[model samples]
Target: MNWNDLERLFSPARLGRYSAARAGDTTKAALDYTYNLQLSEAMMPMLNVLEIALRNGIHTRLSALYGREDWWETWVADTNFNWQNKEVAYAKAKLNRRHEPQTPDKIIAELTFGFWSSLFNTQFQHVLWKDLRLVFTRCPKHQRKRHNISSALNQIRDLRNRVFHHEPLLWLTPTLIQQHSVGVMVINWLEPDLAVWLNTQDRLPTKWAEWNITSD
Candidate 1:
């Protein structure tokens, strides 16, 4: 079908970008929409690995630092962790609503990726970076600074949000590829063998190379 028909079915709001980007060429626009789906699909494995690994890394380190797996309880009560007060409350409230026990594992799984990434914020470096920074076991001593890991987590967080939201990512294939690598790089620092396994599950590298070559 043509752009007019596709737009009608999919809603102009949703297809407008593809239509404009393709200069009203229905075939090109459709192809681009399809490509976005394929790319986003290929992105899931990488994003999943990044989020899980980062969250678990934080949970493990913090649990040890505070001497409890349920460290959220401790942090929530401490005035120093004020930035996270609401998020911690929300996780607890939600668990209460769902009838799930506020276990450490459940709380970690419930926290948003934004919460995990925000732990790397510069403001918390003095209080948390010294300990949380140890999560990157394989990272070089010099390169294990807070800012470096924070920047990588922020990049991965942004890319993960975009891909999960179904945003178009083919326009900047090379740059997108570079951004996604931040996740892989962080994973490598955490566990080299896990990073190797991540590559096995990841289709992004191959898919991006193929699409970038043929995408006009």
Candidate 2:
């Protein structure tokens, strides 16, 4: 929420410079490196959490549309989560065994890209288009496009990469926050549908408004 937090995140080097300038001690350089490393490490699980939420959210939307309770459980069940199994395939496919056993840098890269894009070269654009068509029958190209959802997904993917690659991330900018907001927008777009679905199950979130789109 704080702009300084973002600055400390996406561009920690800038903050390091300021700190080094303020502190004439030679140890300030080491302090800056330590700070940068800590921030990058922290970003890993934070971005992972966002990615997990994204996958869960997407599946929730799809399940609501199709009423496939079994499929929903299968997608998330701990036993079936294999990122590398041969049976696993596609955007919603299970994670590889290697990912589960030991998350490698390469696995992180694959996850960062695979979650947003189709695994089998399927035209995902049509999926977004379908959602848009359902919501807005006819509108300007700008309005017709799933801007919020697309933007949010892209931001999540991008942040995932930055985190996986050990890039500095402490201070976030307004633009970065806006990117996270895209996920919020996607959730908002599907809220009514989700509400109807949840009502049937009597599991409505009591304080949905408290949910801000964050990696955490």
Candidate 3:
């Protein structure tokens, strides 16, 4: 596509007002490279931590609740809990169609981040506060509220969606940093060792230091 056509396809307006301010000077190629780099350096690590914490946290709680690793089927069968049934249905379908038998761990690993994040919705408040509270036992005693966890998950989910869709992130540095903190906190809450490992794995700080971002 020509420059104008490319600009129309990846509109600066959709990237937010800050990006629009630099639209005149920034080329599409530069914007694409910057966003891809930002995702790899900043967003991906946070998303990795968040996804791991979420699945493991919920899995641990559910296992304890049902006294089995295969607690997902039991939980899905509970009519009282307001889970997104379609996700469960999809999982079941996949398992059924698989050539080999699939275990709960395999199924859980295959589930999407959306499925895990949905568990924090208000409909599952009972599960969050009563059944899953122990999952976050490492969280600060005062900040162990389910709502706080839910809020953090929601923010991280939004950031994830933005990054995956190639949306602008340079304008949301502060927000991204906050969400990254939330991801780390949740990871620490779920598994201290995992959190420590993540600290070493994370490269966002180094990437940010190297970028030296400036207005085009």
Full-model lDDT for every candidate: 0.85, 0.43, 0.70
Candidate 2 local Cα displacement, residue 124, angstroms:
3.2
Q: What is the C-alpha RMSD of each candidate to the true structure, in Å?
A: 1.8, 11.9, 3.5
Q: 1-216 in candidate 1: lDDT tens per residue?
A: 766787788899989888798788778789888878898999899889888988999888999998988877777667777768788788889999999998878888888988998889988888899989889989988999999998888878888888888787877544778877877888899989999998889998888887777666
Backbone clash count, each prediction separately: 0, 17, 0
What is the C-alpha lDDT profile of model 3 across 142-178, one tens digit per residue? Answer: 9987788788777778877887886656557565556
TM-score of each: 0.92, 0.41, 0.79
TM-score attained by model 1 = 0.92
Cα RMSD, model 1: 1.8
Better of 1 and 2 by lDDT: 1
**Which one wins on lDDT?**
1
Better of 1 and 3 by TM-score: 1
What is residue 122's positional error in candidate 1, in angstroms?
0.9
User: Stretches of candidate 1 above 4 Å error?
Assistant: 172-174
| Residue-level error in angstroms, candidate 2, position 74 | 15
